[model samples]
Target: MALFDDLFIRLTSRKVGRDRFGNTYWEARSRKDAYGRPLRRVTYAGVPEASAVPPEWWGWLHHTTDRPLPEDAPRRPWQKEHRPNMTGTREAWRPPGHDAAGGRRQPSPGDYEAWTPGR
Candidate 1:
């Protein structure tokens, strides 16, 4: 974090809320911009990766909603925790047969057949 931004955030922003994944959302202390339009910002908790921010907060950050989604909003029983982008990292997904994992694919003879025009 640069000195100016650190000072600005500390002086001019207030905590709106934090999501389940630990991302923090903020709003300008003085509501509305110089042109009298709404303004807001977000301070990513860790690596500053945008993908880590939840969908609801992403919407609010982009002004899709006036209210930031409640931090502890109820979730469906089937819901899974959000995962941040792992591209270029060892933790990234490597599907079966992926070159990074191995060049060999599981044999599935019945999975495909060349089309025959004259049956």
Candidate 2:
């Protein structure tokens, strides 16, 4: 959707943070709205894809956390970086035997046997 948002306004708004993908986060500098509630917003890097937002920033955007992830926090080996959803796109993954791969899984030898008559 097209919005008539003024570039000057965005330029002057409080610069919250920038994610790895270049997405810019913002919060009202005034800290509170007319109703005395906190204001937060995120300007996506591109195309405004929901999945494009990383988990850490997402938590802050959604008010799940009072602050974004600490920059100095050590990352665990088991933790993985976030990636946008790729479902239905060419980048999406398909298993080896999937119909899109033009192949079918072959049954392993001795995996099964037909029962004729008991010997």
Each model's C-alpha lDDT?
Answer: 0.78, 0.76
Give the poorly placed runs of model 2, Cα more than 4 Å off.
1-3, 6-13, 29-36, 106-119
lDDT by residue (4-119, candidate 1, tens digit) is 87578768888788876666778887779676755677776677787888877878888878887775779889977788788989889988998988777898789798789998
TM-score of each: 0.68, 0.64
Q: Tell me how far the alpha carbon of residue 40 in candidate 2 is from the true structure, in angstroms, after superposition.
A: 2.0
lDDT score for residue 46 of model 1 = 77
Per residue, candidate 2 scores C-alpha lDDT tens digits across 1-119 of 13544353375467779888888888776667666756777777678888988877889987789888874578899977777789998889988778887778766588687878975
Q: Clash pairs of candidate 2?
A: none
> What is candidate 1's local distance difference test score?
0.78
TM-score of 1: 0.68
Poorest 10 consecutive residues by lDDT, candidate 1: 33-42
Runs off by more than 4 Å, candidate 1: 20-22, 29-37, 106-119
lDDT (Cα) of model 2: 0.76
